[model samples]
Target: MTERRIVSIWLPRLAIENWQRRNADWPEDLPLALATAGTHGQIVHDLNRAAMESGVSKMSRIVDMKTICPALKISDADHIGDTKWLARLALWARRWGPWSTPDGTDGLLIDTSGADHLFGGEPAMLIDIQDRFASAGCSTRLAIAPTRGAAWGLARFGSERAISKTDPLPYVAPLPVAALRLDPQTLLLLRRLGIRTISDLVAVPRLALMRRFGRANLAENPLLRLDQMLGRRPEPMASPEPPPRYLVETRLADPVMDPSDWLPGMIKDLCDQLAAQAQGCRQLRLSIFRVDGVGCDVTARTAAPTREAGHLLRLFDGKLENIDPGFGFDVFRLTAEAVEPLNAAQPGLDGEDTEGLALARLIDRLTARFGADAISRPLSYESHIPERSQILGAPVSDAPAPLARADRPLRLLTPPEEIRVLYAIPEGPPGAFIWRHQTLRVAKHAGPERIAPEWWHDRSGTRLRDYFRIEDPTGLRLWIYREGLIHDGRGAAPRWFLHGIFA
Candidate 1:
């Protein structure tokens, strides 16, 4: 088989921010920024090339950044917005090649072997991609080569002449060793030894170089031998495409202001779109875009792959109210976030197993209204401590597969509290306990199921605990615990705590 060439694209920070600002209605000529606000205040995380030349760099403190560019127009980073646009771009770029992956935060790669002709050949495709992005206000570098490494080096450090597939090495040779993706220490050492360019490193003997740098240095050492540099080995491309799936979008002609007037219809439309797109897919994500510019998204996952419109819609009923068509939503999009291969198992002859499906729908609706995390099913874990053993999991799905042991208490305190006992057994269960300012006499008790401390994770340095399930005079079930062991002789008397109650 002939060697398969690769095309690597790089969109530096300055380029990406410019694109975002232009698309978001900001002045195209003015310096722009995307920052994050934290306790220390706003910090610049990304800047366009103009801003960079003006001394603005990634991770620059807000105060310092202001000093560098007083007229900087800053916008809080919108990761979600960026991701949505990236997905769209990746989808569009798929027309250029069979494979494409996002490069870092602002770049993309395309395997252009068989698809270059459609864009008027390799050079034309490169120019076309660059123009498309530039039209969108994005600055981009496009490089094509026989290897990912070569493409990456050329795109970021190689001059315009280096981008051509033919005679690529001559252009690539002049770039610094950093293009090889070498670590700082190794690059520093190489520089000290008069190795400034990739060509210089290639001239050195591989064994002698390895001996001086040590084998560990080879890790991330981008220098490649003749055969390796020429792309003889397999180099996999991580795709930038938002996995293989379908998404449905609805753009309202006019933004609806009244929730009562728009919510039901909007939700119905979204579900219909999702159902149609998810023909054989199992997982779905629904994103709602409100007129105010804020967006809300939720995901619905099923035990098996499904495309049934009714089942998918019912799953989202609970979350519809939360959509908050803020100032009325102008657009809504539904995407299949994940999918599993379908073998098309034949349905049973009866075809009427609606009970499980009905329950799933109810759960989905409840989750939609209260938030996906609001409703959940109890799942048991392997721990004697009441609170540690049972967990609340999403309601739309069953508990984790290979369900954990179910011997844990039914109810657990939000935070276990200390309790005083009037009558207690030093070696066994307590006779009476005082909890929440109320004292109750324990009529019966069971368990001293001693649970050892997970020392590997005992950050608190507390010792093991012995737990017990005690019944009070009113037949109320209580889960209590005592910390440490008298026999261990490591601390004071064991302290008592009330961890949970059984309904």
Candidate 2:
């Protein structure tokens, strides 16, 4: 197997760095500490180098840290949000490679393997990554090696060693066994046994090490890690996740409290950006983030895939008024949630447009006022049953479907209505029918049209139907059907049903 090169970017103060990004006025050298709830009380989760140097360290009690450093800065830790920020950075780092993952809340691991040459070489790439985080006010420790385990340890402890694949053992052996990423108890046990460094640990036989330490962990756990770090064992990584796009965001210079003050312009700005990125998308989401860390969001979908800013704004006009911006909001983001290909429109020479397009826009507005399910359209389906052949589809655009054409009633009873009938001839056309408490006499009529039940489905209770178009005395035409055949093998008697009436 080919050797792999992994780069570890460690942010020792990830939560503090995230907080600093939000508040730009924070001093670079200020002593800052972040705390999280513990069984006893708030405990320090992370701290800046300034705080660490001032005799306040991580895991120290919040009150104790404050007492130690009178002018220290402290805040509560948002671990989830901090991790998300780290993941986002890792996603953005994909310009280098396709494999990037979160190491922890405070770090990221990137497999730059064959991609380093694009930015010059491995050394240049390392310097570039360091410069980016440094410029962004993110304190970082970057190290690159042939394995993730070694890269991780080097980033935390090694000082820009620039070690090669063949020289790993020599450089790594001198560091304490903690660089091997062992449990504290194991490290303590090894220290008592006069094995404090990787060199001392490797001096013992692999079989003896396995037998001695196997009970605490896997039989080859320590040896396996050493092998993995030295590139002797294979360590496959998970595939990198793709970054989300069709999104645009704008942060305000000043927070806007009232909806009227900022919504329209912000919507127009973000919609224009979305139109560029999401040319054939149907659904879009708008996010309003307040300065106080609360967010309000809304979604809009077009009847067809469209990128028109005017049409999108029209859909959002009334809905934007409903969002309450408590205190004030400072950031606006728009993302295309869904999309599809759309055919180009071809109007008539006389400037007449297709009714389908106009109808779609009308449905778009109506659904914006109502909801998605409130507006529907007829979609043809391939089915033998008459009523089951067509379905109610969303107003979204799709390819047209072919349907069977036959002389049928304008309206149909869901289940054909049973009615009293008088036939002109036995086992023939209906002379008259009484339906819904009304008596009608046939003046003229059309002959029987036979339709059989679908054989593919259940045929137990189904029978052949003979339909007729009959005109009543008042000139009203009624569609009627007779179920069951006259001389078929079925034992049930023939019955009449009122199917529908023609306009």
Candidate 3:
């Protein structure tokens, strides 16, 4: 098998030119530069080669830069714009390889083993990439080798070398110590020791070199060692492409004005498309692009990796209505964000889909149509108070089925309504009370579930609450709470509040 090689391409002056190309209105012939104002209120960080060649280095004052390049057109560096374009670049580079990872401030690494043949081998791939970049008006230096360090060195140092897979060492050897990406101090040390070129350092014995410069020092050195150069050491690769998976997209022939008309179909189409592509994928993202170019995205996750079209479609039904489709959606895309190996399983002999996967899908659809929080499963909290003991959690596909709670009366008050009690016990439920402008007699009642307030949260200075589930003569079930204990010195007689009514 041929040795797999990692290609690293560096664009030294990418930022400055990227800015100029993005803003086409800017004069192309004029020497342009990007600078930032310093703390002293003058331009700092000149970002143009022309400006630098004219003696205007980084952190140079605006006045000095102008004095050197009288015709230089300078603008403030757009860091946000740079980042956005960089992401686009990364996405575009994903077309060339299965793995493409960013390198430093302005470079990209492409894994070429499985991908190189598609572009007619290494040299053709490089030429294609170079052509694409040049067409985009960006200059790039391309290098390929068995190691990232070697590739990086060649890209930055071997500028004059031919763009081929020939031995990279000959090209990298002539470069200065700085090309190794060593710290300034390290480079200064190397210079002092007369170790000017990478070739000079390569001549030294490994043990002696390591002993002179400790292991930590060697770790900081960016130069690839001979072992790595010869493919002995594995070069770690950061995958630039997310992964091969499924994606669904919809482009409207005409702009959509209302979400209701198009959302369901768009979602269904996206889900179906994604399912078709998923094959062995796990997670899917639903992306909606409005006519105005704005994007709204949501994710549908599964317990295990699945490519089931029906299951995925049902999953998205839960969140479909959440998409506004704003001012008319022109495009919709569903991408499988993750995946796992598919495992076939046999159905149970009992033949019951007791998993409640269907119910979960129903809940997801309901939540999607209404709102995420609109549908929920009751969760128990470690509290005695009825309201405090129970909480609502967002509908999830993988949560264990909830056990049925005891039959309770419908209609619980929010912040249980306070009432004048006809009969009351110092430590128990009230027998009868005037509530909601009506005197309700308590026919049956549950005992007090005294819940102490978390003392650690006493910074709020609120008293503990005691709760009781009370039933009225009219079959109304109420969750009420009594604020403050009998002897807490924070005097304001205990107050009763109606929280909720159970259905």
Candidate 4:
């Protein structure tokens, strides 16, 4: 088994240097300190070399620091910006390792287990990392060890840049308690107990120390850190996983200007792969790479998830004509841009009736030829109003089942036209009404179906409707309604109108 190795990179002056790089006009010789809000007031968070030389140390009051160094430059520290840059740096450092992650706000941790040989050796790899960061105007201190804790301690506090594969206790024994990554309170407590260094703490009995500081959190416990640094405890690196891709390509021996014959076979190969993964394509794109370096592509979408090869072939029809295969094509790639799980469907116990599948295929073809918006079916909407009862939606979209009612007309008018009642019974549809500049006599008539306005949705003043199915002398049927009752306190006297027409 390959021995595990990790690298830790620290940037002590990250905030100061980031600010300097962004503002090129600022003099590098000036004493600059980044300040952040503290309990009392703004305090120095980080300082440059010049500020350090001028006695402007971290945690000092910015006002006092200004007095100590008359030319001191103070700016608000951008912790978020520093962290974002550190994350990007960690991702870019993958050239030296299989996995890397941002350790904190100003550092990175990389797992370079068996990859040091690519750079000749461990020392060579560290030197390469230093040179790369130096070229990018960044100051970095890096170290490698058998454990993450040891590498982290050495990068920030230890004297050496690389530790051998042997036990790391000797290298970290003399380091201060802070190297254990403990909280400020723990460090202070250790100091009062006269345990200033790792060696001093290790000399204390483990049972006695655990009794004094209950073993609750790792941040406050020192035993966990010691065990981790000595490789007794496991510390797994949290690396990001790459996104999944579904693509297939074909390289032709000879350049062909027309890909009509090759498209079917490539599509079949892609469909077979999708079936193996138990997924069906929702959208597919075909890319054509030309020998002269020009490229063209086209896309097709389905109404529902499907892996059928015949249906997909028809969808791409007339779409490839727009692709100008410039100077012949050398590559053909088929990729599924979007996919969804499609479990194997069980066939009916009796002989299969493909009526539903055939309808879905027809809808997909029509949608691909035109556009999804151009082909839609009526979807029942949850409303009591006749006009608001249904809406247009995707042909294959999921919707609530339509409401079942009686005596509905095939055609409906948007805004019912007002009719002059020539004759009619009291509190009912007009017997003989004038509509569209013509008079129609009622040969036979059905009853008054009362449809009240929805109280929650309709306005307070909205009136109820009394609908009736009436037939004329010419065998024409009409759906008419009275706008209001004779004396419903909400509105005026009842008015008649033509609402819909029956076939």
Candidate 5:
């Protein structure tokens, strides 16, 4: 097999170029720069040829940039939108090769080892790539060599539109040492040592270079990059990862009036297709398209990844009626929105679904009716404080079902109500109190159970509470508390409050 030849493309002004392509009638005389929020201050992220010619460069302070070019136009960076444009460009580049990966730093790497012949010759291929981008109104540079490292170096450093494969070390020897992609600190040290070019570094013995740089990091990256360009070390071209897509649509010959009869069968069919594409899908969205040209979506999510047809049908039950099919729904689409990998279930004899799995389906139905955040489940938290221990979270899992604590009330009030105490000691619990415009006498009372806040969590404004189980006249058990310890001589005088009621 022949060695793979890589082609590296550099679009140093991609951010501004993409903006110019999308928006027409941009001022040609004014300098443009894209700015993004930085730790120090708003810094110049990407500048155009006009901005650079005005002595404004990338990383230049926004303040100084205005001084250099008063008419300099700076705009917020739309990184995501720019990347999408690059993705479209990548699809266009794929006609030349099967594999292409985004360099993520204003460049793209394409494996064109055996693809040059498709365009007749190497020179023709380079011209075609240039012409394509030129037609799109974007300027670019291209280079090809035996190794990716060599192609990257030549593309960025060599003064040529394209450089054919040659002795890599000699070809890159005269290029600036920055072509090696070394960090700024390392490059500064090398410059201080009078090693300003690749040729100068090649003259220095490897053992001597190791003794100087190997101490900081055992793997000498500068030497390794040089070796890869010289074909001494292997550097493989990595392809871009494709995003996961899951969608299936089905059209019926006749619109259905009764959803229960037709929707179940259609849902089962869509689930089969979705299972084939992605079985480990956690969130699913079902879109119902009506004959009246109206559409509505019903979404459901499971605690864990699932793709069972029966479970999916049950989860989406009654959801089809929500679309209000006036003329009836003629099309149904099931899509996997959020996904996670899960082990394939072992095929077994047909039987009913497990009870444990049913909990997830129940939660799914509840979430479909009420919004996902509308419902919550309680769990026994690690905190000792009664209120803090009752941890409430969304109904997304069944591992921690709501468990009632006998010591704590089932329904806890958000803000404890202050009862008008008719009589009580100066530094003691309430003997009797006025509640709900009715005086209720205390039949019996439990001893004071003192509970303090988690000291590690908060050391400020946290007072210890003394709780008491008091029985009212109507046999109603009330959980009351007095704020702060009387003996500690800390905090305000004790106040009584009704926290919860235990029936």
Candidate 6:
């Protein structure tokens, strides 16, 4: 197997250069420092060349930095934005290698194994990388070696930009212990023990060093870093995984006035991709790019998640009529915006779910003809009151579960109608009632199910209700409820209400 060659790129003035790139109007000759809130106050996080030349160092208080450089420009540091920008820059660096990753907040690490020959040799590759970054308005120090640790150390501290592929310890031994990436606390302890550089630390007995600093922490132990730098330990390069994208595009050989013929093929390609992943799309967008530098898009939404080409193609009917297609279109692209997992299922022998599939297609067609908000269905809600138990929502949403009680009325009134009890037994169901200016004689009755108000939502005057199923002489059954009990002190007299009717 070929030895792995890693490249480490250090951006010493990344934060400063990034800000300057965004604010081009600022004078480059004036000193500038990026400040971040610290325990004492705003502290200097990073500075440009002019600020460093003026003797303003990192971590210096902003108030003190102003005294040193009277014309210094101070601005709040965007740490998060800088980190994101560095990640993007590292991804952009992958043109020369198979993988690249951000190395701290201001550096990048690229694994360039077996890739240098394509751009000449290792030296040429490093020069190309340096020139490219310089052209992009960035200051970079780059080095390549057989090990990540050695490359990292040489890029930041050593004079050489390329180390020998056979051995890297000779070049790494002269660098300072800080190049080992040890913490400040460990560096301070090493300094007190008269250890200043990698050579000095290597001279000490391994047992003595192990006794003083255990091998528990890989990051803080100098021996571990030494082993890694000398190729004794393995360091794998890990790159960030980009987000999944479901998009396909076609480039026409010549500009055409109409893109209608190209859309089906593009949509089929997109659906095939989704099918390969066992996924389906609920929303899609078709975009046409004109040769005149103009672009237009039309979106389609489905009643349910589907990857069927025929169903999806019909949804775009009459959608592209308004597009001007000025000059001509040279490209067509389709993208799936919303996706969901769709596993395959065996069809029943009797073809049971065909009706359901047809209903969903009908809803999708109606929605395409009208608008998204025009098609809706009722979904059951978790509530005790009949009027608050169902709500209207998108037709494709989950169907409401069956009611637990079979005695529920087929349809409920929006606002229950008040009724007068013409005659009734004391504390019992009414024998006769007058509703909507008509008297109804009751024959049979079922229940007086008592229901209590929701204490968390109801006001003080709210009272309990007693519901009953009453059948009149004409065989018409009504759901009736008493609003309050007699002498309950919540209201004057108990009132009766016609709440619903049976099927």
Please report the TM-score between candidate 1 and the true structure: 0.47
Q: Which residue ranges in model 5 land beyond 4 Å of their true spot?
A: 215-220, 241-503
Question: What tens digits encode model 4's per-residue C-alpha lDDT throughout 1-503?
Answer: 99889999998778887777678788768989999999899999998888999999999899999999999988899999887767667655665674889887888898898989978899889997887676556788888889989898889888646654668888888889898888899889899999999999899999988897765588888888888888888877787743226777776767898888888988898899899999998888887766543456678887667888887888889887877875677667788888999878866777673666667778888888887677777678877678888787655533333554669885789888889999878766677989999999888888788888998998899998888899998999999988887667877778888888887
Pairs that clash in candidate 6: none
Local accuracy of candidate 1 as per-residue lDDT tens digits, 67-178:
8789777767777767665555555455456477776666677777776776677788888777756655556787888777788888888866245454456766788888
Q: Give the lowest summed-lDDT range of ten residues in model 5.
A: 213-222
Pairwise lDDT winner, candidates 1 and 3: 1
Shift in Å, residue 399, candidate 6: 10
RMSD of 1: 12.6
Cα lDDT computed for each candidate against the true fold? 0.66, 0.73, 0.65, 0.81, 0.74, 0.83
Off by over 4 Å in 1: 1-5, 12-121, 159-178, 182-228, 232-281, 286-298, 303-305, 309-354, 358-370, 374-394, 400-503
Name the candidate that leads on TM-score.
Answer: 3
133-204 per-residue lDDT for model 5 (tens digits): 775666788888878777888888886665646567767888888887777888888899899999999999
On residues 76-101, what C-alpha lDDT tens digit does candidate 6 reach at each position? 99998888778767755765674789
* Worst ten in a row by lDDT for model 3: 159-168
C-alpha TM-scores of all predictions: 0.47, 0.59, 0.61, 0.55, 0.48, 0.55
Clashing pairs in 2: none
Q: How many backbone clashes does candidate 5 have?
A: 0
As a whole number from 0 to 100, the lDDT of residue 270 in candidate 6 is: 92
lDDT of 1: 0.66
Give per-residue CA lDDT, model 2, range 361-463, as digits (tens): 7878888888877766667776655667778774543424335355666567878789887545675666666788887788878868887888787467678
For residue 408, model 3's alpha carbon misses the true position, in angstroms, by 3.3
- Model 2 alpha-carbon drift over 4 Å, by segment: 25-31, 161-163, 218-220, 240-385, 388-503
